[model samples]
Target chain A: MLGIDDPWIWGVYLLCIFSTLLCLVYGLVNWNKEGEQEALEEKEEEAWEESEEEMQQKELGM
Target chain B: MNLLLLNIIILIYLLATLYLGYRGWKSTKDSEGYLVAGRKTHPYIMAMSYGATFISTSAIVGFGGNAGLFGMGLLWLTFLNIFVGIFIAFILYGKRTRKIGHNLNAMTFPELLGKRFDSRFIQYFSGIVIFLGMPLYASVVLIGAARFMETTLAIDFDVALLVYSVIIAAYVIWGGLRGVMYTDAMQGTIMFVGMVFLLFMTYSHLSGIVPAHQALTDMANLVPAKLAALGHAGWTAMPVLGSTWWWTLVSTIVLGVGIGVLAMPQLVVRFMTVKSNRELNRGVLIGGIFILMMTGVAFTVGALSNVYFMQKLGNISINVAAGNADSIIPIYINAATPEWFVYLFMLTLLAAAMSTSSSQFHTQGSAIGRDIYETLTHKKGGKSILVTRMGIIAAMIIAVTLGYILPENIIARGTAIFFGLCAAAFLPMYTSALYWKRATKAGAIAGLITGTAVTVFWYLFIHKAEAVPLGICKMLFGRDVLIASMPWPVVDPILVALPMAILATVIVSLMTKGPRDKHLAECFRGVK
Candidate 1:
């Protein structure tokens, strides 16, 4: 196809380009899918961190 | 190129890198910030860091050099790298890893596995393996960057090695993952621009894409007798199926690295460096294009360098390099590109090397300090970071020493070896940790040991590429390989060890008790 005689070689060459387009399209389609959830996750993560710190302090007898 | 101008440009780049490192150091206020970029990295920075750390000088100088010798067959690795490394990795693995790691508060790859399975043994064992096994890989990367410096700047190799190591270590030890990823993003941009220019110049120099491929294909008859005997048919064709050349190309070069990318400790940790799946979704776009530019340009330029050399000097790339495939890309850049581009590409190679080296040192440090030492001593928080900094120094010394002692043309093979080992040893357990709820602590440990043992045994006793030079088989069994038979010695360890590890993991998990329901729930929390 691209002037290379081997189907195996040219097939992979085309596939590399195709795969990148797949990623670009996929990213664009879902760029903002979970926008609302991030804020909630951050709050939960902070709570989890505080509890984790308390548990570690208890273990160390601090 | 003007040495004075080049030196000033390099100084600016170095200063900029150090400035970014300082910014990272400034932001890092706790163990979490140092370990995982505070787990809220930007999508662009995360994607660029991942791609830059993943590509490295190994891809450009080493495998690009292999493309010079072997042909466009190496493009299959690029296909797998994009499809598997970015797309599947980000969508399928990244989301789950981020959630699970957050739930368990796991900072490193070993800690993730350790926390998931509730086994300190798994964490420390994996940590020990990484600490012991990664220097060979790191050293080869050091050698790749050093070789380019030697070739382009006319610097001594030893001086290049020492200077490169010190620069990478200074930032990695102080700034941690935050520093590594920040610099990686900037370095990745430089690499992207340099590679785009390289690909454009290559095709334009050869009069465009089709003409370049046609020229390479036309020169098939020039395949050296030695390479042809090993089943090298042409620069544009696949090696004769099942021939020695085919096995090395497919098994060692292509699949070894292509599939192996999934389990790399350094690359896999990037998945846990983000807040939510949205960032990963966005990252996939940037990562795909970045990887395409990096590997695609290098391999294409590597292969077409032959045509350029043939037309100019009536010799092929390997001959021009005097049989060292490692030198092909560097030689081509020096001979084919204009002077100004040479200076830009020098920064490109430097970025490639520094970005990856920084990540390796960080991962190795975490393995030793966070995973092994902290887990063993029951110490946590600030003390571990101090130990981690020490570990980084130890890793730097080992890698720099190896850069001095390791033989020429070892870059690509060394990289493949580490990737394959990680695939066999960690992939099964890592996969099971994410997807298989039934996977038990006993099962994970068994799989880890069996995969590691089998890979080490194969490298020492059967894989001729490593065994012959290692001479362990020759000393123990009075032969180069325990199996001197055709194709047996040629088969890569990943092909052998990975399947066995998977089987052991599945069967052992089924036979043993699974993790407690409470632990499993904790691991699976928020992990849709």
Candidate 2:
């Protein structure tokens, strides 16, 4: 009988908790920074902006 | 009985979903917008949509049922889901996929690969496989949700399945990716809350996690003798290594899903929906949390249900719903949760089914409409959306047919089979297209053909569970599998076929010409 008192069982549970907390902390700390704009080539930036405008216009039309 | 209230709530939910689909329809003025949400979607929407699509009712109900039988070892899948399915996916694959998709103006996963290799054959081949293979997965999701309704609402199973199918088709055909994502975000939230409540209720019922697990572990002797023969050690412990149970656990269940996540067309396309790598990075944590709650709680609750059943009936078996393991969670919910909360959980189940099925339908539709037809006819724009809509209807019909006919315990196996198939067939070429500049078109085609061929051959002839279905080996060779000395039946096709695929890619690429330097430069542009 492998019970909750078993060290191996506790190890598994702890690993899960540790991994989940790591994700949560990392996410919260870097949330804003991650979605910040990245530098793009001028040519690529113009094309991206044009598409973004098109998307906005289409949404407004809807 | 609150039946009328349930109906009204369900009706209102349907109307809201339809309204969202209509909004998506209005905004979808072109092919790019319809297929990929204009590729400018917010990180939150992308994350929720990705999470919801990945963790369907099958994970909650079917795999939850599986957890009841397999025990805590299944938590390994949750770790993989967060690590591989979310973090690695978002950080590694998502960045490259989005950048290359933008560079190539590719709208679908197969198209992304096809354009990368400059091979129309790769495009059409992938499209056909997705159109054919995805229905098995989608139908299982449909059955999972319908079973919940049948058990909870007392509706006939067939009727529940039909109604569910029709409603999902209505939204997916109308809304495209935008509609799917919008509803998925809403659905994802419902799933998160519902699972959290179920977890708390479970722990509170057993007093606490420690007590619940302790009780479950104490009942290890209660494991059926037949299961013990198959190498089930105990609920709280991993199976004995090199045992048949271990093979099934690692090869079929764990690796089949863990590695398979990387190649999923529906999940992969979500990476391309966002604008930049930043959006993917932002999505990583939310996706991880969503997967953790969705899968972790389900597995825990599943194992603990044995304790609940034991306390209530002096028996510890998932036999409440006619001995079907798939119904363990649904039946448990009926016995455990308050009536009002059951109604809320019903929405959660529906969300799980619809979110995943809609993505499948949408992807399959796009595969046929954009990847296949557009590749052949060279049509573009609003016309492509029309073709996709038609394809959605076709896909729904096929999935609904499969939903009606599939066998018991098909939920977990069906999900695994599709994931395994995708991993075997697509992962090698897809990885090379992103990272390996020396990969050739001939190598990709060889890997694709050989990989798909081997998986089909294995599933039809050699796979122990599936051997008799086709009856090729049983009739001709007087045995199910040629490798009688090895545990061919227990080993997953992915364990066999994925390596073969990589081998095929490497050998053929070494023998043939590689991608053009200009093409490689363009594909790898800004990739670092």
Candidate 3:
């Protein structure tokens, strides 16, 4: 509380808070994937499923 | 004051990094895998490694100290870190870079340039630039961590510098890129945890969040006459334009590092490690969050340091007391934090220095091994991985020698020199490779030459290019005043050099017609 409450200084602070909040919002919304580990897990799951499907088809053919 | 515990913590951190390097060395499938991490890094590792590699001790020790000295205006860079550094870099650049890098099977920065443009000459030239120029940065980072060690532990500068360099270079030479990443992942963890704790401790030390910030504002509004005249309105204030403060805040630091991140080879190499574009898409959020924590916390704490120094020393800055701005954070650490916290911070800084140093060494080695040795010498080596390993050793040796030779104030000078060079040499080619189908070899060459020449000329002669170039050093009302005041480098080179490079690239590309590579153009096609 310097007591002046300078607009210019406070404006800078406001911008920082706004930007941080904005970054936080965007960051959370986009939190799903950023590193490939999550995607790799999904791909592995899909591959496992496809192999399982192929096994079923072969069993049916037999 | 017990010091043995601190020594043990640093040694343990060093041992872990060395172990990771040995593991990487033993498992490298070939040169490519060793150099580029097999291009199959899981997104989490990739993201953490990328963030870790970029968020060095320099960000924490050097520039964080600067924010404390300069005021809170430097926080703009933290915003840019998330938005541009992580988001735009990943989505806009990372996706395409990974796809093209994989398609071309390129493993190094210069290799990417050469393969993308079908120009080996470009590759070799870029390699030379990186190799010749990176030492300044490597040495500076070496110095940054060393200064912390020297100040906090009261060790000799040379011993600290040598020990840090040797430890980092060993991991990099032994482990290669995979080792760097695995180590980076760990270091990144240390940094994330350390900053989080440091942030809380800093706030607590101030008697609470509200009191801490209020103290900062009180100090800000009452900035010494010299600082006030230069536009240091407060901790939360931006510098006034044309004031000495404005140019420093807006131009040198803000531009030098903000855009410079795009051209950093070590960070760029991380983009190529993943298996797919989707993988790159995944690393974005993690990278952003890590950056927010690493950079955001550092800037916030750095700003808070002002209040601490003022309370303790009866002045806003303790920089002059330690004889270097980079020393501010360390002194603050020792004075304000508990001994255990000091050990943790030392570990965090050591992690930052080692992680970045190892990557810088690896990149330098790769530039020589993959980009130069294989391409230029045309030496059919026994194995490219072998060549890279050898190159890593060679680069480490050079870095060690330079680390010893450099004068004090290593961090700021180190960042500016390497980054300014990268901006000049790589930024144009990078922009062209991604966006413009018409970007020609001539354009790339023109841009490189113009940018490199201009940035160098300015830095050598510009005031802004020199020590704390952010302040009233702009060439307003003619640089004659500056030329008279300083010995050389009266203006910051970026303002003049960057435009010249862009203009040259566009003009040359237009004159030379489009590139012959249809597939190259297609990389940019199918988008808006």
Candidate 4:
């Protein structure tokens, strides 16, 4: 295939191209699919930030 | 090429870079902005920055030269680069890292691990490792860029070194990661264009892809005697398995760099720059294509350059380069490409150097400022940006000094040494931190220390590539390597150290108490 006799070499060459297409397709497919998760993560982020701020305050007091 | 036209092109590019740096400076308002681009970076910028930082001049010229010497077998590295480096990295690691980093309010790679495990010791220890180990890598990159300038622009080496350092330092220190990434995106675009052009030109020059590869494959009998002894079967085929050439190509170059990239602090930090998994998903598209063009083109052109040389000069690439593999790519470009394309290629090299160096400086500075100093002094975020800027200056000075002082042979080994060390020391702990809830602080520390100790021991004693040049083994044991055995000396430290690190992490974690459930919940929140 592709004029190279070695399966190890040409197999890798084809796989590189194939994997790149996989990434492209994955990206396009999931482009807007994370909307609900983003909202949940935002709520979680707020709670975590509050805790981190409290920890910082306690350290400053010490 | 006309000197005046070249100067104008360079000036225009530099001015655009400075303008982007200035824009980054104007936008940076807080420590978050400086440290991780306010964690709201565009997917394109994040992906481009990551790709550009990952591929450097040495990756192009040096490894490309290796491809010229070795064969299409080097394409295995490219396969691993795209599949492992981009796909698995973004899908599996990036999402979790971004979520956990946000949850913990972590700003850097060391900080993320430290905060997760509630271990200041881990934070500062990792920081110290990075601050100390990264200068060698940074200096080598600095030297590559300066040498390119010295040859192409006819500037003195010292002047090139100073000017290049000052330009990168100005943007990186002042604008921080924002400046670095903004400039990186632009530079990465240039690199993409240049590489794509090179691939097309090389194929066209050889009449097309299939015919060109067939021509190279037909020339397999031209393998030099010395190379054949070491394991050179042909240009289109893998080296004889288990030979020195096979071991060096597969173990040291392919696996060492391929797997090692997962744990690189600079690359890992980019995962924290974006806002959500959606951005990372988009980034995967850009990053995969960018890396494909970069390494894929370099290795293919590198292997096929042998065909070009044989047709035009009646010699192989190594012979044409006078046995220096690093010169083969530049020589081929000069001989085969038109003059205008040479100018574009020069910009490509410049972009590659600056992009990689800026990320190194940023990671090093944060290691000292945010991770080391803050943890040690019990200081928090207020003074971090100021201290980080100062740390960037310090790192730049150290890199410049090393660039001036380090010998070329030792300098050439910098990237591999750093990559191998990072993989050995950090990969186990980093993976455990992300995935294994049972992993304990004690386990992390044990893995870290064991990994570091084993890798250092290997380099100083067992790994012939480094041990010979370092001479610690020769001085102490009176041998080139501690083990004068064949494949043992050729085996990379990561192959030995990473498994040990994983075992240490797993065994010690099982033996010790895990982190509190509440903290683990906090870390794992939204991680899936």
**Each candidate's interface RMSD, rounded to one decimal?**
1.8, 4.9, 10.0, 2.1
How many pairs of residues collide in each model?
0, 0, 20, 0
The residue-by-residue lDDT of candidate 1 on B1-528, one tens digit each, is: 799999999999999999999999999977888899999999999999999999999999999999999999999999999999999999988888888988888999999999999999999999998999899999999999999999999999999999999988878999999999999999999999999999999999999999999999999999999999999999899999999989999999999999999999998899889988989999999999999999999998999999999999999999999999999999999999999999999999999999999999999999999999999999886678899999999999999999999999999999999999999999999999999999999899889999999999999999999999999999988999998889999999999999999999999999998789999998998777
Query: How would the docking of model 1 be graded?
Result: medium
Off by over 4 Å in 1: A51-62
Least accurate stretch of 10 residues (summed lDDT) in model 4 chain B?
Answer: B406-415
Which residue runs does candidate 3 get wrong by more than 4 Å? A1-62, B229-231, B319-323, B380-384, B464-491, B517-528
DockQ of every candidate = 0.68, 0.28, 0.09, 0.56
Better model by TM-score: candidate 3 vs candidate 4 = 4
How does model 3 fare in lDDT? 0.75
What TM-score does each of the candidates earn? 0.98, 0.94, 0.87, 0.95
lDDT of 4 by residue, B126-230 (tens): 998899889988888887777667667778989999999999988998888999999999999999999999999999999999999999999999999999999
CA lDDT, every prediction? Answer: 0.94, 0.85, 0.75, 0.88
The positional error of residue B46 in candidate 2, measured at the CA in angstroms, is 0.5
lDDT of 2 by residue, B190-304 (tens): 8999999999999999988778899998888888887788888777877777777878888888899988999999999998888777677678888888988999899888888
Q: Relative to the true interface, what fraction of contacts does candidate 3 keep?
A: 0.12
Clashing pairs in 1: none
User: What's the best-to-worst order under DockQ?
Assistant: 1, 4, 2, 3
Candidate 1 vs candidate 3: the TM-score winner is 1
Clashes of 1: 0
Q: Residue B522 in candidate 1 has what lDDT?
A: 86
- Candidate topping lDDT: 1
